[model samples]
Target: MRPGHGGFITVKNTLLHCYCVCGKIEDAHHLFDEFPQRNDLISWNTLMGDYLHVSQPRVIVDLFKEMCIGGFEASVTTVLYLLSAIGELGSYLGGESVHGYCIKMGFSYNLHVVTALIYVYAKNGEIDLARWIFDGVAVKDVVLWNCLVGKYAKCGMVEEAVALLLGGGLVGELSPGEGESDVVVDPATSSLNLNKSAEESTPPKLSQP
Candidate 1:
């Protein structure tokens, strides 16, 4: 630790996290670019997660592609955050591609990874696949059930959401990495409004007198 610095925080990385959290992505990127070991796996994953912190999902995907070119190995956190970004960005194909990557890398059995998978699939309107993943979980919990509920509600699959709420027997489960477990779903404010078609715009025909 430096003379005025805490044991864990530093000017480059810690400060980079602060900048990213504050939505100053440009500054954070500039600092990350200036760092000598920017390609280091730790540095790369930190920046990727930081991009997620600010909701810049597209850039995070691009960054991961670049990381692949550089031979970087993605940790579970790496894929978790990236899957989240894909869901938010509506990159369904990309999310599916990442799911393949998870299977290839043997991370599919991880509960946190599978939770993110369910969220990503639901957000991408692939509820069948999402429920498939959900079903494979032997030990279900509040986080998993709520993740599905929120996505179903946001996607206007109210029937599915109701079914999940009514049928789910939730217990406690371990929280995933930072920020993943803290999702708050408000259907009115979630921004993915696809329910406009369900309003029954055409009136029923009246019986002829």
Candidate 2:
């Protein structure tokens, strides 16, 4: 009897671990419900991590909502994974919602989670939001600082770009424009005034929305 109990417990634990890694949440939950005891933090986080891993990012957000509604307390690991999944989706709205959750849960101090928040905002074209997150990160690394500057520059914030560049963030490098090519132009095409000829040859087409 003792040998059978030990073997069963080991099998159960192994199955739970696999379920989390493989993102088989429904199966894991079913097994958990059938087991006599299965409410450990590890088990809970494993299930959440699997949900984040297996589902598309948007679906992962829904899973997080379900977990929150179910009154399951989240660990730092779980929140970090959730933030990363949100960033991966590149959805500003979803990231914002998760940010609210993080604030409410007092997870605002987690460095990894904060960095994920910044990356999510930047990827979603919300440089202002990303800067806000970066400001809160204590002793922000040079890489993180560059992310904010580069994001602003990419979004066409010229003055902001210059400011960041002056502050030691590497700004855009000077490169030759398309017009600076060294290849000799064909005589016929070169002699033709491209702008005037294009205008004379064809009128711009209008498309109905």
Candidate 3:
């Protein structure tokens, strides 16, 4: 690698991300294609993430397939973006394949990854699988708890949702200030809303090797 080439790639990737954030999908793709280090996993993930942000989930799935064919190793960030896209598309099979891959890669236990998995399963109406995943996590955060409970409510399991809300010790857990505001439930409407934490939306910083 030539001196400053890595820096140049970093700058270009940043510009690509900015384009995506600004909703300039075409410009972002063009910038991504022009990169000399376009093969970098970070660049692929960034572009895919941007496509997902713009509601172009189909684009993300295609990009993911291309990235795999290019022999790029997916990081947790990549999996999260892919899972979100799959969830949007309601593709149970695709979610399952990604879930299997996460287990194979040892990423299934990661909190963010697990949360994404729960989302994909729940969105696909596989609430049982989502609950199983929630049960598998011994140490649960409010986000995880809220995810399952909210999914249950959304699935019309109001009784179970209320039970988990009142009997599952979530109220007690909130007293300690652990994601208290993230879980909101309305008994009258039997509606549950789980606000995503900042960490859930922000991709981890990438360090170029």
Candidate 4:
């Protein structure tokens, strides 16, 4: 805690973030390791995020465990990164543990977290659990809607996926027992192979401001 010590840490964190953004992950990691305050949450999160960006999910998971062992309480950003890594690794048990942590820590209601949960479950072939999580959200965003629908489609539940879109589930307006006749399905939608479409579609990113 010298004068301007916090500001110095901020500057270093900024540089680390810049290096990561510029795809210089090694440089970023080097800078992070050199930080006087390795306990800095921003630095930890930034480095972990860069690892995630590089598709080094195991690295991210390792860093997450280190961060936890260091007694740093995870923020939403931290959880998002960890969840994405777990999903990429196809660790159903890890995803479930994180889901429980989110609920315990009061992040389960966050739209981004919920979306990530859906993704992890779907990726692990737990589509039913994903759907259950989706149904619990009272408010929905386009990203969340796309996530669930895409997951269903990816799992070859074409009817469920199509019903979501056609029944206005995207807008949270789907009513129980709503018949397909109430809404018009576009010709393109009718012929589209939802599984293929889902395959080409990228899942929404879990971003924080």
Candidate 5:
């Protein structure tokens, strides 16, 4: 169980992260609910984040509602993952809601947030919107390149996708096996669609969401 706000919460964070990465939602939720520190936005996000990776991303909708009711203001990171979860649901309404919030709050310009937005739009079949976002980015990174390329390839925009993939060579760091590169494996990918569960986990399940 979680104690008062000041003590051991950091330890809880470490274990909770492990639980999330290992697909132990039940244990993660148990520890999360038991924590008195649930009043904090970070605590809620940490738990909410774990729920986003699993197949049941809709869980985040209910949790976000609770977070709002609890008066925890949403941050750029919060909306980023929430958008990812919404994307997994193929729910444009939810995605638009988050996008509206991001724009209203001036988070639309944040690099990672926009990247996630592009992904959500692309995954939801809003390729035009995804391209719009991608085009607006003056200084693009490899992660965005992978996303746009993947989505374009997925959407059958082969020429454009191949062009973008090949264009990376000019950046000099890109190579044949892009996924093996450091930038390709950035933690921002977790912001895509993360939810942890015991069913998909190996031995010693940490959480049960």
Candidate 6:
């Protein structure tokens, strides 16, 4: 049986696991604060992961910053968490700085890190930078290709989107490419198309909801 009152690291890990499983982040923080020993990297990252799972991604960034202030060396997983949070937050400057940090840390060669960077840049309206990253990947997957193509189409870069379709490099599982792939239209894409029509319509000033 585990001790009722263990060392701070052990208690922190137990609380973190409980938080992750039960999804009670507030209680987790309470336990974290009650511990006398400073939280190690695992404690910080575990809590950060819990925040990510809860869709409160922006919290992950603040957690990472606090980890740094506490003198904990961030793991690659911590960097990924921060990047994911930045992507969700649409904080382009923060994302760019994180990207540079990853590069300086020699995590530039890590595929997952690179992909997150590309995705963050693309989602933040830097599609060209996303494309540069995509092209540099020696083994491009279908998901990466689809992300690049869809972003191009979403941004009204129709020609580039078409070129991606025509390149036949990779085929996505959910959304298909140009000719014979049989694509399913999602509501968001359909609504975006409708918005584009509204912008191009006669007089161009349509009623807003």
Q: Which residue pairs clash within candidate 4?
A: none
lDDT of 1 at 46: 68
Specify the poorest-scoring 10-residue window by lDDT in model 6.
179-188
Candidate 2 global TM-score: 0.58
Instruction: Summarize candidate 1's per-residue lDDT along 128-171 as a digit string, tens digits.
Output: 99888888776655666777777776777888776776776432
Q: Model 4 over residues 51-164: C-alpha lDDT tens digits?
A: 876788899889988888888877667777788789778899999999998889877766667777888888789989988887777666665677777777667898998887
How well does candidate 5 match the true structure in TM-score terms? 0.71
Off by over 4 Å in 6: 1-11, 36-38, 172-209
| Model 3 C-alpha lDDT per residue in residues 98-207, reported as the tens digit of each score | 99998898777667777778878887889889878777776666776777776777778988876877866776554333222222111111111112332243422322
Count of clashing residue pairs in every prediction? 0, 0, 0, 0, 14, 0
lDDT per residue for candidate 2 within 20-83, as digits (tens), equals 6676767876775575354444455455455555654555566566666766776555665566
Q: For model 3, what is the alpha-carbon lDDT of residue 160? A: 82
User: For every model shown, what is its TM-score relative to the native structure?
Assistant: 0.70, 0.58, 0.78, 0.76, 0.71, 0.72
| Candidate 6 lDDT by residue in tens digits, 90-158 | 888988898888778766665555656777787789988888877777665454566677777777888
**After best superposition, candidate 3 residue 97: deviation in angstroms?**
0.5
Candidate number achieving the greatest TM-score relative to the actual structure? 3
TM-score-based ranking: 3, 4, 6, 5, 1, 2
lDDT of the candidates, in the order given: 0.65, 0.55, 0.69, 0.69, 0.66, 0.64
Question: 4 or 6, which is superior by TM-score?
Answer: 4
Write the number of the candidate with greater lDDT, choosing between 1 and 5: 5
- Residue 177's lDDT within candidate 5 is 46
Ranking according to lDDT, highest score first: 3, 4, 5, 1, 6, 2
Worst 10 residues of 5 by lDDT: 197-206
